[model samples]
Target chain A: MAELTCQQCQELAAELALDVLPGRDRAEALAHLDGCAGCRETVAALTATADRLVELLPGAEPSAGFEQRVMTALAPPPPPRARRWRVAVAAAGLAIVLATGGWMLGRASHDLPQPETDAQADVRTVMFAPLTTENRQIGEAYVYPGQPSWVYLALDIDNDTDVPSSTVRCELVRRDGSTVPVGTVPIAKGYRGWGGPAAVDRETLATARLINSNGHTVATAHFRHTRRR
Target chain B: MRGVHLRRRPPERLPDDMLLAGLGAGDAQLALAFVRRFQRTVFGVALAVVGDSGLAEDIAQQAFERAWRHAGLYDPRRGSVQTWLTSIVRHLAVDAVRVRRPAPVDPQDLMSLIATITDTPERRVLAGETSTELRTALAALPPEQARAVVMAAVHGMTAVEIADLEGIPVGTAKSRIRAAMAKLHAALPTPRADHG
Candidate 1:
């Protein structure tokens, strides 16, 4: 096809910027634009103004729960294991100064901060464990002891299948088999990353199991019982 | 004063890019804040284009989801978070309206929009200086040009489609759109980098 002349291109700039120019004319104008600087400048300025036009629309509040709904549609989270792996590989690569020990385990320890910082405070660090399904690891759970206690969760939704919208339940099981609910979190795509502010009795949590929305246990992180250690 | 200590700002206080990062990383609180910050603007754009509240809501919701999904790709150098998001919601809204087919844009709706933007102080504030200039310029245009530009820009109507809607020749439709855009372009405080 013959390229559009500069006059033709300039005439089409407004429609091109608006993105309403017909396909053939658009192609010709763009072909002309590739070689013509002046036409390009005109098109660019017009395009910017067209986009800024949307900003001028008056805002209107939608019905309530829209925020909640949008949250439910959040991006796929980076799984706890994935996050640890990232920190691990990054640490291992950066562990040049500390190569006296196994780079792997030392980097893995970075996942837990201040394990012995406040031992006399009566807070326990019963588990900083990875949650795994029957076939492979999918998430990680942290049951760090504190005044109230805290739980951190990282889960990948695609253990063997893709179920990003599945809501995963985190429960801390006690010695008596009674369980405390950490919280129900929605996973998008394959990963979820959440930090601890969940107030629970860390000393009492004997096991951490991730249950899918269907009430079936999907992954479990066996707590390293303090006595067993 | 001795016991006072610095603390991290709340999620609501974080800049737009930070919230978007949190949204991409799937931090629930940040995701909620991101939604809260832009929900009304997204919904309004969607509603204006589609002119159906129910469908607009769906498109708005989908817009958020898409933004979350692709938030990783956002670049600050291209535009502000609001501009990036406005483009997303606008595209989604335009696509939704297009699917409804043969969209006969009401001149009244476009006129009402112009009136709303120029008359409402909050809307002007939301738009900022450059956008406010464009809004005022839009409000100042001849009614035919205002309707023509809006139909093409917001609804993604071609000149032929607009001509059909207004019972005018395609050349007349193009002239109106071109004239309105030239005026709006002149109103911009500074020529912005093109996003398209």
Candidate 2:
């Protein structure tokens, strides 16, 4: 991973705050954060904002029996009882199952005390952006973050409207509105095709578009979160 | 006079923190109250990310169980019980999808979340927030940027995930997230000179 300068660290602070900066970059940024106060403060403020974003999603009701199910799941095990003759007879049959695969052992494990689940457990986030032409959905982008985190694109461009190319250039628009070439993907028989790894860069991207062999934009997908207030 | 009148309030009507305290102490009624109070919000959060009602239900249950177990450790300074529980369920739901289905949700599907949800006083209470400064700042942002920031902030998605999900390059994803967050952070109230 390239070592991040203070400027770069500050630039990626939001990713770090949101825990989405990709692997080595994340490690590099955290190292920079340890030595840099301004960056830490910047990241902290973003973290606060990120935390507040949860309020935007509205709550909805679960199934009717959910409450009973939750309470029943939380119930403690019944006390182990002293055996009467009939109980002892039933227990002997149960002992056979316990000895074979140890079903009772599994049940016993739950009886033990458990450590409190951390409120701040590590969570992986996924994003899906649709590809469109003239406001018509044509395909989608599937993304996951990790070491060299990945993106896969599935495009089914309608040639009748999209001016499909034998091959299409996948171009991404940057934060500065400059366009970067990812690569070209071929259409074997028709416009329907898919390409992967999609060359997700380290810089922030604004939009993605497909350019035809004629250098004309055919389909574009603008990634926007339109969560209403 | 306020104190005299308050004593008549039902256990179900107790304040959030008090209910949380009761939950931590394993008070059956209070625990039930806590579950009832936040179940919808918790279930909604779970369902939003996973997009599966059954999986969402399991996640919601686990979230409530976690809340019941960890209520004592909760910090009011961090957020209200509702927000905290939402956070828990959101993480759980994300984790569930990562394990059950790694594919990204449709951008339209996510956009529909805002459109489909209605604003209500109940939602505000569930959010455990009255001050709209942060939300206002988020709203002030361009639609694309706000969505990027929300995907990162609420869903715990990274720039790579956003890049992949948006079918954009990683740089563009990072830039959108950074720019959005910076704008939102700028909107936060500045603290006093007592800064640590």
Compose the digit string of candidate 1's lDDT tens values, residues A1-229: 9977887887899998877787799889989989988788888778778878877776788988776666765533423432343433333333332232221111122222322211221122224666677746665565544333456665545444534365668787887899887887666644445543454554466778778767888778777754321
Q: How accurate locally, in lDDT, is each candidate?
A: 0.67, 0.60
Q: Which parts of model 2 are misplaced by more than 4 Å?
A: A1-6, A31-38, A78-229, B1-9, B116-131, B190-196
lDDT of 2 at A9: 81
Which 10-residue span in candidate 1 chain B carries the lowest summed lDDT?
Answer: B1-10
Q: Roughly what TM-score does model 2 have, to 2 decimal places? A: 0.57
lDDT of 2 by residue, B1-196 (tens): 0011101235675667656655654557867888888888888888877778998899999887766654534455555666667666776776666575457767787667634432334565477654356556766778778778767765667777787888899889888888887777677675511112
In order, what are the TM-scores of chain A for the candidates? 0.42, 0.38
C-alpha lDDT (0 to 100) for residue B80 of candidate 2: 63
Among these predictions, the greatest TM-score belongs to 1
Model 2: per-residue Cα lDDT at residue A18: 67
